[model samples]
Target: MNSSQFEKIKNGKGFIAALDQSGGSTPKALAAYGVLEDAYTNDDEMFDQVHEMRTRIITSPGFDSSHILGTILFEQTMDREIEGKYTADYLADKGIVPFLKVDKGLADQKDGVQLMKPINDLDETLRRANERNIFGTKMRSVIHEANPSGIKAVVEQQFEVAKQIMAADLVPIIEPEVDIHSGEKEKCEDILHDELIQQLNALSENEYVMLKLTIPTKNNAYKELIEHPRVLRVVALSGGYSRDEANEKLKQNDGLIGSFSRALAADLRANHSGEEFDEALKSAVESIYDASVNKH
Candidate 1:
């Protein structure tokens, strides 16, 4: 890892600072923001919309430039050479760190086993990303209740990937997704925490920087969810949720990175009419950040 990257991780201030650095009174905090499938679909209109949304996020009052990490899809990064400079450059120009999602997608677990295929050329991808001056890279592994053996395999893969990322001198945000498609939130938390511990144990030798949980919150079983004892330098709430739902999850996660999907798109639309959506979202972020700092 670069000296600076190591320092960032060592100090573990990246996410916390991202949330707390805004003007003392401004009710806005965002550790990181991401553009999902709509940003990757190879459509001009969609790309333009995402670009506009990115602009709004970077320019939003009290949104710290240094702390904002933007997750860019493979396709977005791929087209950068022909379409424009790498997405990293575009984001860096706006003072946002660019993160690449390296996982192919979710694994299909059936009959208590998960079949996962490796997706990217790690060395090449890291080299390209580094050349582009992107901030970091993220790879996700999934765990299912029916798949104990698969979970062990996935954890091993995550450790290997983390080693590769470290060899490339890049920060790897290790995401182990426990899908919400499962019935009970309590079951999700149990599976998630267990997988997290397993992955951490496997990567004990490596300096894995962040953990991005799929939901990180529960509607039906909030009280039963327990926080891990080790400090999670950064946590991200996955996308595919409403703004209110996103805020609720962030509140539960204690000011981790807030990764939004439909909520961000909706906010982008609201921006056109000068609505209060931005303020509302910002307030939610501020509350989480403040509460987290106070707890610390």
Candidate 2:
């Protein structure tokens, strides 16, 4: 990524709202909203409902540039228009940088590591995103255990794609989420930190990347990485925590801001009136914003 692109992302101040659920995740979200998966006529039908969810999120009351530095979009939502306003343009106008989720989804589990499904059409997607002026991109992989081999696999896959993503002039949010409930959370963080240093050392000189780690067991588990010159910003995911719990952990993490979905979107319903929706959204944003402000 160029200095200009890096500056744009830096302007985001580490608050990224991840609304880029793929087809598989869309179904669960739909089910939670009372839509049955069997009720859909086709497999990819949940995308339609997800679009509605996206609309609600982007248009929700009190979601301004201050509340959200950016939003990560699903491929479908990336191209959508609301009230005749294009998605990317809509966000940019509000000073919220727009990013896209390029990875299709996760592949079948392998050696206890779950990697993101490759994006066969990534070149085309990157081209489209560039044309539309998207600020960055994000991809996810899961770390289920403390195995160094498994952690290495996840880190390599994320960085492999990250190089290509940065080459396209878009910042990459490299997410290797260690399962929060794992008994090995602390060990996994240690392993992941070592792996991250090794992986970055192999990158070309002057390369930069962002991290979206699962909230680590220790608030400062990634202190070394957070201070690394090539790492722009480190952010955290809720990793199944409730909104309140997420806030508590997020506030404790000295260098990380939140890139949360469930925690940020917190129980906002589709049927709420405009006043009610905005009120709920404002509350969520304020809570997260307080936690995100650097206190160290």
Candidate 3:
């Protein structure tokens, strides 16, 4: 995506609505959405239902005002079409940016931290995403503690992948998410801060990076990182918190927007009246937007 489009997402009042669940999480999400537990057995069955659910959200009457700046989609959802329109086109028509999740998944742990697996046939995937008009991409790796060596390894791998992504002409949301439940929360944030600085320091003077971080243990922990010359915008992920808890923590944060998944989609899913679904979705979006737009 271009700088102007990134600016639109940054400056807008909306947070990214993450519909990017894959694999077992799809069926889990369907169940959470109130689908019967026996509704689907495998990926194919679940994918069709997910497509339907997302389509419902996209076409909902009040979704246009839900303060949603963008959406991050799973590979299956990213590749799907509605009637004659690509899903990306469908969202773009509504003035929402579309981003694709590009990492294959997590790899075996190294230094007690899990890194994202390299994607398969990534060039082909990026080409298809661009062909479908996707604006950007996201990949995730985890940081489990204050271990300097582990954090450095995670940051290096993520930036290596991110450098490749930017080379392909798409904005990359580098997510090196620290586990919130881990101890030494503030210390971990400090380690992450230094590691981020080490990696971002290598970028050319004007390159723009978007980060999707775990909500800081201490408010404004990454303030300097986000203020770096190469960083465009920084957004937080829920990292397994409940919607209410995530919203509460986000309130203490500064200069960061949200790209949350569980919290953003918490109130969305099955069995509600159309009006009920829209209202719940709208409320969730607004709460997230309120937290995200907070200034330092």
Candidate 4:
């Protein structure tokens, strides 16, 4: 583990940028960026376009470590290059720590929750990540309601996988997202908080993990988790929230930082010229940064 990178994540005053749109979600992400489905003929071409978008974002003046502490990368992104350097290495050079999205994707919604599908080659994946100088990993699960058993299962699965990631000397951002549209959203957060606390308490004093969760219904809802000894940090995902809404809710949480996807790119368009794109990205980064690190 790189102690410097670990320290930056532990105490950095910035949010993480989530650019890890995988196969399942890439089309939507690209469409939001103004690249429609008709733009690409095949999966290879599709990945190429998305990678170009990622490369442009990374190389842009608006993207750097000053207001962006880290970034999460899709496996394909990790396997690609940017400016003659490996993607992870380029991020490191730009002073932004890099993380890999390791989960295969989500399983069916059973018991009112969607768990991560089995990662058949997680060890190999971790090995590749380490070789690429990746700093950490992110995996996600979803809870659709306030089912205690379901939420518990989600947390358990998250932590179980986290142990493997930690063993590889990489931090794990365990994310069990409570669906923003769930009817029992508040109750779901309550159950999730207790379940997470239990898991945090079970960790050894020397062990540490990060969390990426949906902003809860109540302000500072995960305050206890944020203060837990084993918790390195707790960041909020935009989920389905608009950028403005996500930023507004983010400011209400004192310790939570943003790890937004759709929200971060809300102002950007694929047709925009380089100057326009950079300006839009700059605006988004500044607003999200303020909400994350300079909260009211």
* Best-fitting candidate, scored by TM-score: 4
lDDT string, candidate 2, 146-175, tens digits = 888888889998899999888887888898
Candidate number achieving the greatest lDDT relative to the actual structure: 4
Segments in model 1 whose C-alpha atoms lie over 4 Å from true places: 2-49, 52-56, 59-63, 66-95, 111-116, 142-146, 204-206, 215-232, 254-257, 270-296
lDDT (CA) per prediction = 0.50, 0.80, 0.81, 0.95
Worst 10 residues of 1 by lDDT: 18-27
Which of the two, 3 or 4, has more lDDT?
Answer: 4
Which is better, 1 or 4, measured by TM-score? 4
Estimate, for each residue in 14-121, the C-alpha lDDT of model 1 and write its tens digit.
232111111211112121233444334445544454444444544465444444334444434433542256555655565545566665555666534343457567
Output the better candidate (1/2) by TM-score. 2
Q: How many Å off is the CA of 26 in candidate 2?
A: 1.0
Question: TM-score per candidate, in order?
Answer: 0.65, 0.92, 0.94, 0.99
Better of 3 and 4 by TM-score: 4
Off by over 4 Å in 2: 1-5, 11-14, 33-45, 294-296
Order of candidate numbers by TM-score, starting with the best? 4, 3, 2, 1
Please report, as a residue range, the 10-residue window in candidate 4 with the lowest summed lDDT: 199-208
